[model samples]
Target: MTVDYSLPKPELGAPVRVSPFIRFCRWGLLFAGIAYGMKRQRTLEQRETAHRANLRAQKVIWDEEQKKIATQRTREQLLQLAKDVNVPIPADFDTQYPPA
Candidate 1:
């Protein structure tokens, strides 16, 4: 029988054979990932800040609406009082509540 002539393959690639361009691309991707994460964090912080500001604005608006409703209720009660006493109610009766 004729002897086999194929050579045995090596277990691993040669050392220091990694291309410099591929290495640079790997490092560039790593830095890009870090920058992207920081940008996402900043965006989240901005959104939270805006949400807090909106909530504060809404609270102010709610307080003003409540004040108006309370004033109207107070005026209605004073008008009822005047009716019970058979007297004319003052136009500025709303300014007086829990009269002292």
Candidate 2:
């Protein structure tokens, strides 16, 4: 048996004008970028949901405080009205009167 290793080989046509392998790599990179963008959008949505919940809780607390202040103001005004009319003021007028 004889081995044909005597002659050396030449380059094949200036190494293919444009490589298909490079194009496939570029497409893979593009797909990865798209996936990252989608994940970021979902993260933003979760943050917004949490922020909205916090805002709602704060609003409820503020509303309760405002109601207390309004009740106090009404009680003071009624006491003044009673004094002006020479009427005896009740001790528990706030508890008895309905807030408008």
Candidate 3:
């Protein structure tokens, strides 16, 4: 039996070359994805900032409301004290006097 030691020759044809247009399209798609990601990040940051501002505004409003409530309570107590001392109840005092 004769042993074959010769290697098979490779087939020759036009070299496999990537088209420039295809390369351009790939690069364009990559850049478009980066731009989209950057835009999305900016939008999210803006939304977060706006949300924080809204929360701060709400806190300020709540603090003001608390102050107003405290002031009303103090006024009511003063009016009650005046009544207890036999002082004349002013007609303009609109708060309902508590039962003794």
Candidate 4:
């Protein structure tokens, strides 16, 4: 006689049974997960906001520096042009474009 070794086929219409303890904790687990997610999301949003603010402040400082540099260059160029043409520098020229 031959021995049977094949596993039985699963029934498609069988109902799944959940443990009572797990079912009792389902709502608590869902709420805890949601609470944790919200806390993490809030932390991330705060960090991103702080980073953006830092970038904005840096940009403002950078723009101000660029403007200052441009102003200085323009002043120097004007002074040089006046000297090349043998024009006397106005008394207030130094006051307006104080030495770099």
- Model 2 stretches with alpha carbons more than 4 Å out: 1-33, 84-87, 91-94, 97-100
Per-residue alpha-carbon lDDT of candidate 1 for residues 1-100, written as tens digits (9 for 90 to 100): 9999999986985777679999999999999999999999999999999999999999999999898788778767777888999998766664565343
Please identify model 1 stretches exceeding 4 Å from their true place.
1-17, 63-100
TM-score of 3: 0.44
Scored against the true structure, residue 89 in model 4 reaches a CA lDDT of: 93
> Per-residue lDDT tens digits of candidate 2, residues 1-100?
9988777777577555667889899999999999999999999999999999999999999999998898878877888899999999777775676555
Clash tally for model 3 = 0
Measured on C-alpha atoms, candidate 2 has an lDDT of 0.86
Look at candidate 4 and tell me the lDDT of residue 43. 100
> How many clashing residue pairs appear in each of the predictions shown?
0, 0, 0, 0
lDDT winner, 3 or 4 = 4
Each model's TM-score, in the order given? 0.44, 0.51, 0.44, 0.51
Cα-based lDDT for every prediction? 0.86, 0.86, 0.86, 0.93
- What global local distance difference test value does model 3 have? 0.86
CA RMSD of each candidate after superposition = 11.3, 15.5, 12.2, 8.0
Runs in model 3 deviating more than 4 A are: 1-15, 63-100
Model 2 / residue 41 / CA error / Å: 1.5
Q: In model 3, which residue pairs have backbone atoms overlapping below 3 Å?
A: none
